[model samples]
Target: MVAIWLDGRMRPSTAASVLVISARQVQRLLRRYRESGAGAIRHGLRGRPSNNRIDCGVRDYALAIVRETYADFGPTLAAEKLAERHGLTVSSETLRKWMIDDGLWKNRAQRRNFHPPRLRREHCGELVQIDGSDHRWFEDRSPACTLLVFIDDATGQLMQMRFVPSESTFSYFEALEGYLKDHGRPAAFYSDKHSIFRVSKTEARTGHGMTQFGRALAELNIEILCANSSQAKGRVERANRTLQDRLVKELRLAGISDRAEANAWLPTFIEQHNAHFARVPARPKNLHRPVNEPASRLRDILCWRDERYVGNNLTVSYERKRLILEDSDLARSAVGHYVETYAFADGRVDLRWKGVSLPYRMFDKDQQRVTHAAIADNKRLSEVLAYAMEMQKAAPPKMPRTGKQRTRYEPTGLRSPGPKSLLAKRAERRVAEAAAQAVE
Candidate 1:
């Protein structure tokens, strides 16, 4: 309307009044209409391709890489791999659409149920949520293993991650050592009721009513809080889920099929992940306290400790293995006294009496079997069984006896039963004679 009125030679002031706009706006409209006609008023770049659009060649290259290398990866991870490995940068959503169109990924119709949000801690290291996630991290390239994750409750930063054969006290101790070395001693560790952190049985024989891990943390002046439910420690639980998705693919792409390789690569991954996802804490102060103990003390505290009573011969039994203390005045005095044994994760065992090292020789009384099924965790169960089968196959077969096979009641010894065997023969002869007379 303003254009027509202006074309009819209406004054700029009159057009502005009719259009409820300033005369400057009316003159600007007139200029636009005269310069490019009516259609030029629309956006100039509407019908053109986006300047940021991915090129066809790049898209085809990325798609080809995805199809060959990341066929099982989700869109987000596939996009990341395309950018990181192939140098083909594309938006995750664009990659998702491409994957959906190419039949490489599926969009699920199911909706995710909401989980009520929990407030984060006020300061970093106030509460470190820890857990172990067992998965096929290397897929079929190697055996499955457990990843120990320690995440801060406040910042959601992964404080430490270590790959282990299983979730055991030794594994947690190793991870905790790394965490303390990196971030100091946290105020408290939040975790699930795994036997490593909590005693499952009420009648358990822990003298201090604490697990080995709990004892270690207590000695370090750090508290351990066991969550009653998985939701209570949801931070680490959710992190485990994300890691199972992202970290697995990362290991696969890096060709990391073993725990050593994964552990070596974890620090870099942690830095990148935290840089991307860690949040600023409500308070800037770090809640972690510097450890006051010496490195040796820390090592002592982090090991598996148990008390054993020395027998009359200065012998002690641990894990079905016997140890003979060297005969000295002090060692002889230690006989019938209780001694502490510290078993380290690296297979080092130390015996101490009143904080003094005791020299001893180990005698393995019980033979160790190839398979430790009872002690193996879910991650190593299959491998343990497979190894046991192999060991059985490689074992030598027993020889068949002609006529010297012993009966169940027969005794085999270095000395022969001379007098005893003759007395037993006389008794058998007398009994047979009495039976024959009775029959006649």
Candidate 2:
């Protein structure tokens, strides 16, 4: 109170007189106020220069290198990149602080101290976060790949990860099938608003109302919830960050190069990783629910789609041989009409005509014409011939032979190189002529 009173404008002598404390105390308080200002009252470290801070130019250089090529890098690795590539002398902590202040970096798996309104799902298999991380997974050894990660929200366990060429409906189908086989289907899948899961298709103001993946999930009775923002489903995104870091290192150490080896090694790696990081039981027993679908139905649930044209004989030729739709309404009505054929991964085909179910018999599936087959032979052959003629016309004219060279030389076919030594060749030719004339 005396210190504050002195600071507020009470005369030093008057403050000492009021408090009965020595004037030296008032002098010390005033000295501290003068030296440290209001910050002194807060206690602990405040605005002091950190011993671990990176030098400004080196920090800026590190920032530039990160921005140019490695912006997604976390601090520790970014620091190593700085040391190796940019020659910046700095620790990870220093780089972290500099980047955090600059808003160029964040700790992805940071733990918050406060509680939120929405708690996690009660069981491990209740909700799973699914996302694809497109990464240079094998670093220099392989081209980039997409890792389709399925992580449980409650237990933070990575259920399955599939390395794919790209993120597509079929890729997810493959991933989901793998996930189901490993841990069974979760009650609901939480994911981003990617077109695969949450596409809104419109056709001249009329809605298709179903994407391929959405339809697949619907058929499987799996509910999908799309998060509006990244933060809403931070778990999988965080997992993507972790996997991108750890998986890259793991692959490099294991000498795994590219998609083939990485994929082959993924199962073993996942087992080891999950063993180390998988969370302990919160409620004792495992919460993963078994798949409810019959094995036959599950087979048809995951597959690609094809389209077929019905013939005049009330039969559809699929996979080569004629698939006679016997007494079939689809065969009778869909004559001269194109019908859709959904080809499951397990090779089962489902045919539908104008949204009506069509019973199909895939007698010779190998001979069935592809739904959207390429151009026919005659058309393609004509196009090739026309292209050849056009290429001949467009090509540059060849340089003509000069004076003496034109008489004996052919231009296009194979030819021997002209002799470098004219005298040696002339003597040899003269000797040959003398021998021929002598024989004659």
User: What Cα-based lDDT does every candidate model obtain?
Assistant: 0.86, 0.75
What is candidate 2's TM-score against the reference?
0.49
Worst 10 residues of 1 by lDDT: 365-374
Evaluated at residue 367, the lDDT of candidate 2 is: 31
Clashing residue pairs found in predicted model 1: none
* Per-residue lDDT of candidate 1, residues 148-246 (tens digit): 999999999999999987787888999999998988999999998877888778797657789999999988899999998898899999999999999
TM-score of each: 0.62, 0.49
After superposing candidate 2 on the true structure, give the runs of residues whose Cα lies further than 4 Å from its correct spot: 1-118, 201-208, 285-287, 292-294, 305-330, 336-340, 344-440
lDDT of 2 by residue, 1-440 (tens): 54557557687778888868788877776677778886664535557767765467776877788788878888889889888987776788888888887887876555344434346666778889999888788887766768899888887888888887677677789888888888876788998887777764555363356677877788877888999778788888888999989989998999988676777789998888888888854565565667888876776667765567788876776656667665666468888887877776555667777766677565554432222344533313433345456655766545666777646855788677776598888999999999999999
Worst 10 residues of 2 by lDDT: 367-376
Positional deviation of residue 15's Cα in model 1 after best superposition, in angstroms = 64
Best by lDDT: 1
